[model samples]
Target: MPVTAVDTDTDDLTMTLVGDFPAPAGRLWRAFTDPRQLERFWGPPGWPATFTQFDFTVGGRARYEMTSPHGEKSRGAWEFLRIDPENGFEVLDGFVDEEGNLTDELPTMRMTFAFTDTAEGSRLTNTTYFESAEALEQVVAMGAVEGSTMALDQLTAVLSDLRAYAEGKGTRTELISDQHVRITRLIDGPRELVWRAHTEPELMRQWMLGPDGWRMTVCEMDASPGGRYRFAWAPEEGVAGEPFGFDGETLLAERPRRMVTTEHMTDTDYPSTTNDLSLYEEDGATLITTLIEYPDKETRDAVLATGMTDGMEASYARMERVLLG
Candidate 1:
């Protein structure tokens, strides 16, 4: 995937993706709309995806999984913000934890994809928005630009595949599918106290899950790389509710501020996925930086079909009340 640089340094690194996929407009359109067809060829280099559920409509929701070669899996989702008939669509995306919960500690983005017809091919343009340019830059530094291109290139291949399968396609068209998770709690607490409230599990449990039926089942601290421990969460009630359970193994753990883990769920037949959570505390608040690393950029993308962004926002709204109380 060739990533062309865009010069708008709004947050960290923000870019408007412009490219030409030399396929029919409908073919490209379907590649962006249909989930089943998307699973066929909807990722960067090595990651492959499986769509769990996809609903493409205003305020509709969807979910998907991207599995790495190492048997690792990353999940993502989106909420349809706006959908134009044949021009473009916008959505929010994020990493969803097991038990069907999107973490409050992650950020989400609004991504708009527009298509235009050209003589040789179809023009595809992507615009992404964040609360701040720094937020955009952090993720870009973590590898957003390349990831976007990889997904686009995957779309190109999927469209070509649609052309070939047009015998199966009847016509030349296929379908595909595919948050700012920022914590804005102008809480009234000193920096150290707020930091403690986040780092300490007791305080975390009080605010993290709110009064809902969500609770941490088990939490162990080795606090170092190669450390073995598990962090499990489940709903308080709704026995048949989301996230039957998810277990994470320690990968990187930095005391007083950061931790990284390899997360796997008890249900959902998928492999382990990596999650990096960093804590940045200042005079009166803390900024948690979470990086969910996939086998590659593509898988982080495939699961992005689900609407995890809004979930995070709602969950954090719940978190704020608990934290303030």
Candidate 2:
């Protein structure tokens, strides 16, 4: 997703800026609510921000300062008026002195943020109501519009990194034998969520790709004994690799506990294999273990030589993020 242009609307008493983010509302909400994440993208480029105080709740107060490379600092504060997680919030924003006190000489505005769900992702509509027309003019003349646009552009990058970090965590693989490969990971979420991520097609697609620019274009599952499933991936444009696809039949599906399937790589020279996936809760985390058994030693060696284990590790890391999110 790209950083969209900020739309501005001005009148006698208010200045409204609207923008869209190609991320889920829940993720965007966390960025706004979490101070560590907020400070990373709160200021324009080249002016890093530091949060001195952040209490993200109704009637709470927040204080921060943005410093330029030349050592110039601009302080600000927010008195939160209302907060609705993943939806919207309202705050009284104003300039503060270096001592963390609101400055009387600067203008103050009431800002409301509304998050709407869209097909593309989330739409953030920010409306700032000034005390007077002169107040609006003063802030605009001080580069409020330009500064906000740049800050939100920074937010786009921060959100991307957040997603990547969530999708790139602890994952490992081991070659137990020529006919078996074992992959293990400790996911940082509940076992139920992890189980759903494995069984549901909607959740499966989010993290089941081989590599970047590749997507699971097809995902179908029947979580019952004797049921079948199919998954296929389409490579990015201009990529030379052939499409990858597979079909499997479920031999066991114990919700939130274990699953067993016989899988066949379609349109390939490989033979069918059996996959045993089991999950358990350990110390408030879920431990996922997958064991793949090949038809022969040669077939397992050939698949391993193709570097499929690395891709599987990447995909599992992505699955961790999906479960966390």
Candidate 3:
């Protein structure tokens, strides 16, 4: 197990777990920041977690559900209190209802996760501050210590698979749920330039084009919260595909790091998809992850059947070529 110790202090009304990992602090940071990587080990062995919503910013909230082997579920939410990139973060952790609302079923706690370099690798000091000694005892009695230890132990496998999320892996798509799909691409460019390539019209047209025969004909972007944007693509004169476009209104914009938008096909009454896009940089390269929530399984399947990931890979490959140049 990666966890070295689990200590409960009634005097301080807290529970602390210490874990040592072979990966560096940055890798650990990404594991926590990326929902896809995080879900891999956040829950205990039998109860796997799925983050339905992860904003990952100060004041932001993350909602997740850990489903048991027999379909029972435990929902939880984290209200981010402070974030210190690659070092630590503090959150108000609590249980939630099926609709994602906080509930009183379990005691809420303030948890702090601190990361530091160790002789062999990195160490994570995770301390949970309970409201009272009774709360600490309550959690312990519920097996929080054992559950957390097993969860942390699963991180070893996730950290060992470095190449799976490294740069040059090209565009990858994962069906996170029946209605949610996550797409990731590590671009060989800084976060600023990558963000610009996505927001700036001239830069966007240069790489957002999918496949060799098509070109972006319209690239209109507002890029501010609540602002609307539109994009259209047309096949080169001889190419056979029909022209297409998408329009969306930004829901949140956190500058070079995160953006949330509601997207819909232009001129269509189809329900919109909430696209949560996040960027993380490591070793000077930026990884772009977009979690798209479709209306239903049918819509998700229809979109995937349309060769979305293949087109995305082509566009992302083009992005590296143009952005790096």
Candidate 4:
């Protein structure tokens, strides 16, 4: 939300992004300079970046990889061109290989990140210069605008204490796009236990029930890549709704960190959704983010209209109070 405007000029072969933050210039500057803070927002929501080498000197280079939920890696590098403390910096950004060597898979660009003081707080002016209009159009068609905006929006949370930013927020849902929805909750427990609650059959049965009347009748799980899981719930005696279940296969799992799965309604031809689950722990608590990608906009809307968020809230509250506590 901090990103205020974006402008593209084919004639100039450039793209400019403007953002206003409530933090001062020094704070915003640190966020860009610190590798740890940069890792928090360098990529979009589901794809997180990890820096393998960060040399911040004027002539130095930094290498990082943004990893997708499906275990795909996109490597990149930044060669520092200019540096002015608390004011701005310039870097030549381009794709890199796994060995940290620059690659030509995508065109490179020069970028300038400038920070200045303002009455409200600080302003960030980011300008990217492309060698040609063709390169600019190519990057734009590759979702550069949406990805950059979403990445910067995540900086709002990173600018504050993460625990304070997320605690007590309960289960919240954000429609990321026509076919994608993100659900998040801050669990009041360690990452390991939270991961177990989702993977272990006994632990999952204890807290995965959506509502008070529902009881888990079947809970089968395998928390490994290519593994399959099935969960079914039935209403308690005297309750009304019929029994229902979901089955899914784990497409990827990174132990306590991230997992990607395909979920489908049992015994139905409904299109499956890819659920990307990621966990970030800080100060003894874990933040759980699940990005669900549906087949189409209609399917996404239908799933959200089912009061799915409310059910998830109830289930998560029970998890925190009964299982995590």
Best by TM-score: 4
lDDT of 3 by residue, 1-325 (tens): 5899999999988899999999898888888889978886798754668799999999999999986523468999999999998899999999999998888768999999998887888999999999988888888999999899978976875776434455567778877668778787877778998888878888888889998899888899988887899999999998989999999898777678767788899988888998877676666778787878888999999998998998999988988887785
Sorting all predicted structures by TM-score, with the top scorer first, yields 4, 3, 2, 1
Q: Which candidate comes out best when scored by lDDT?
A: 4
- Global local distance difference test of model 2: 0.77
Better of 3 and 4 by TM-score: 4
lDDT of 3: 0.84
Which should have the higher TM-score, number 2 or number 3? 3
lDDT of 1 by residue, 1-325 (tens): 3233444557543467787877766677787788866764455433456678788989987787765533467777888999997888988876687644676665677878888888987787777777676677666776666665665555543565322322121111112221111112223334455555545666655655523566767655444566565555677666445554556666544354445667676656666666555443433434443445555445555544543443444444555456654
Give a tens-digit lDDT track for model 4, residues 59-119. 9999999988677899999999999999999999999888878877688999999999999
Assess each prediction's global lDDT (C-alpha) against the native: 0.58, 0.77, 0.84, 0.91
Greater lDDT among 1 and 2 belongs to 2
Candidate 1 weakest lDDT stretch, 10 residues: 171-180
CA RMSD, predictions in order:
19.5, 18.6, 10.1, 1.7
Counted clashes in each candidate structure: 29, 0, 0, 0
Better of 1 and 4 by lDDT: 4
Which residue runs does candidate 2 get wrong by more than 4 Å? 1-12, 162-325
What ranges in model 4 sit over 4 Å off?
none
